[model samples]
Target: MGAEVITVSTDTQFVHLAWHRDEKMLEKVRYPMGADPTGDVSMLFGVYDENTGLDLRGTFIINPQGTILNSEVNFYNMGRNIDELMRKFKANLHLSKHENEGCPAKWKEEGDKTLKPSPDLVGRVYEALQ
Candidate 1:
């Protein structure tokens, strides 16, 4: 779980402060909240909506080597699932350590059995899963 999380918004710094202070929406947030009123970051991430002057929900997981491991974009109304994100993160970490293995659906932890890609696995995934 050695990861850094930062959130970027099109709102100004004052707006972010107000939301954190008055609205108390982000009062408990411990990570940095970057204000990108100019939409530079949003544009870079391709989440900015030019017409609406807003950003869609975008989540990116970048590895330590500056490589993007996962990228997901959703409509403004759609919320993200942190648990699923954590699962994917763990799987990525596991794969980085075990390059010969593959994580299957519902693989959650370090000790979870991973799939070994092979011709024998073809047409027998259900049996392999069991």
Candidate 2:
């Protein structure tokens, strides 16, 4: 994946610095941790919680063209899965080159079978996967 990763939160920049300095899990982190104290960036992404004055956990995969390829928002306690994100990233990349094709739920990598949407595919997806 040749994509840039940036994590944004409502915390201040100093808080991000402190986390990077002391958090064991982020010891080797190289990506930027954005501080959105005013929640403006989070609001733009529709992840801001007005009642809580915080941001919900959100992950967005935006392409170079500024179009969001994938968006996922979860509660504060719920975390995300890297495997599924990777799958979506791969699917988007594959679909960009094959606009007429559709990646099924089981599609994981290149060369995996894809569906060609049509009236004939209405109830034949199970057969197509086989």
Candidate 3:
């Protein structure tokens, strides 16, 4: 899980990017992420809160071709769901490998049957929820 971590700050004139050779901060992260001073990337993603001048603490799953597959920017009283994010990533990757279907809400791998997007199916799901 040697994923790269980066932060966007509006303090310096340029972006900041650094790494931690030591793995003291978190597990599975041998290197710590760096930050960009200007926060260009954050601005582009609309995660840069102008009032606070800080990123909204979001995560993005980008594909190999540099396409953003999923993104969410939320800070106050909200945080990204690790399990859902991982599930989405895995589902997308699986779709790339095989001709599978999408994931429904609270969907776990081989967990439950997914409903298709249709009027009848929607009514059934609504009834089930009720």
Give the per-residue lDDT digits (tens) of candidate 2, residues 38-114: 99999999999999989999999898899999999999999899899999999999998999999999999999999
Q: 27-116, model 3: which lDDT tens digit per residue?
A: 454343446556787788878877877777777877777788778777756866778877877665654555444456666665445444
Indicate the TM-score of model 3. Answer: 0.63
Which regions in candidate 1 have their CA more than 4 angstroms from the true location?
A: 23-25
Q: In model 1, which range of ten residues has the least summed lDDT?
A: 18-27
Q: Which lDDT tens digits does candidate 1 get at residues 52-73? A: 8889999998999999888999
The lDDT, on a scale of 0 to 1, for candidate 2 is: 0.94
Q: Could you tell me how far off, in angstroms, the CA of residue 116 lies in candidate 1 after the best superposition?
A: 1.8
Q: What are the lDDT figures for the candidates, one per model?
A: 0.89, 0.94, 0.61
Full candidate order by TM-score, most accurate first: 2, 1, 3
TM-score to true structure, per model: 0.90, 0.95, 0.63
Which segments of candidate 3 are over 4 A away from where they belong?
1-27, 97-100, 110-112, 115-120, 126-130
> Which wins on lDDT, candidate 1 or candidate 3?
1
Count of clashes, each model: 0, 0, 5
